[model samples]
Target: MLDMFRYNWQVRQDWFEWCRELPQERTGGMGSILATLFHVANGEQIWINSMQGTPVIVKEGVTSLEEAVEFTELTQSITEQFLQSWDDELAMKTLIKKRRDGSEITFTYDKIIKHLIAHEIHHIGQLSIWSREIGRKPVSSDLIFRDY
Candidate 1:
């Protein structure tokens, strides 16, 4: 699971680099590249807050990829610290969250990590589509032959 987390982090970094070649503005109403990247970074932060039972404060006005990268690195550092002391017993523990409609959802710590990873990959698919629309090749999503 830790390996998966590390791999996703590298994949995100590669995507950010690929996005740097594109214009900062939106091409076809899909969304601006840098804005989408910010969304991904913010998603990690929201999830970290959820895991820590803290407030989920959404940031705004991050219009540059460099700013997005900074936010991502900060959130990743917090996640890394959390994982460093993780154990199987904690992974088995579940967190229950109440929805606005008064419904409840439960997730294991391990599953939360998996969900965050999948969330990033799903957005990467969106980035890939927008990249193709703009006549650019996206970073490869392949896991094979990766350095980490």
Candidate 2:
């Protein structure tokens, strides 16, 4: 699973590089490239906050791709630190999250981390599709090619 995390980190780096080449006009606002990428990065931070008993800081307004990359780097650093303390006991520890409707759901740390990776990949696929529509070749998502 740690290897998977490393692989996803590399994938994210590639996606950010691909996004940097795109026009700034296409990277802002709702449903835009940077918006989606920011959401993925923010989601990672949210989960890390929950696990670490820290306050979730909400960042508002439009952000540049460079800023998004910086935020992602920060989130990844926090997550990596959290993972440094990972163990069988920590992996099995469960956390309950309350939804907007006041419903609660339970998940083990292992499952939550997996969901975080999958969530980002899912959004990255959307970026890839959008990239194609704009006549750009998107970054590769091939896992086998990754040396990680």
Candidate 3:
């Protein structure tokens, strides 16, 4: 799980750096680079909170590139803290989470961690598409690119 978190942090940093090189119009427009980043970060937080049987605190919304980058950094820190505090029993235990639409689901801690990483990758793909469409260089976000 720590490895997965590190991989996500690196990919998010790459995306933030790439966004910095884009024109303001491309980076700050509706559904822009920052919006995607914030969405990804918020999704991870929401998932983590749900898996922990805590009330979801991060709200979904659009944000500026700078704000998204900052939020991503904070999210990474919180996730790392949670990972460090997690016990082996908690990692292997199952969690029952209630969905927004009044549905309930069960997932193990390991499964939640996997879903979080997969969700980030999915958003990164969308961000890459947007970056290409806006004439910016999209960073490679593949896990294999990360050392260790």
Measured by lDDT, the strongest candidate is: 2
> All predictions: root-mean-square deviation over Cα?
2.1, 2.0, 2.8
Candidate 3 segments exceeding 4 Å error? 25-30, 53-55, 60-62, 86-88
lDDT of 2: 0.82
Instruction: Give the range of the ten consecutive residues with the poorest summed lDDT in model 1.
Output: 22-31
Order of the predicted models by lDDT, top scorer first = 2, 1, 3
Clashes of 1: 0
Clash tally, candidates in order:
0, 0, 0
- Taking the tens digit of each residue's C-alpha lDDT, what string does model 1 give over 5-88? 677789889988886776556543226777776777677778777887778766874767788889889878877777787799
Candidate 3 total steric clashes: 0
RMSD of 3: 2.8
Model 2, position 133, has a per-residue lDDT of: 80
lDDT value for model 1: 0.77
Given candidate 2, what's the lDDT at residue 37?
A: 76
Q: Give per-residue CA lDDT, model 2, range 1-148, as digits (tens).
A: 6677777778888988887776664643346777887888888889989988898868973457778888988888888889889899999999899989999999999999989989877877887888888888988889998887
Error of 2 at 24 (Å): 3.2
For residue 53, give model 3's deviation from the true position in Å. Answer: 4.3
Which pairs of residues collide in model 2?
A: none
Cα deviation in Å at residue 23, candidate 2?
Answer: 2.9
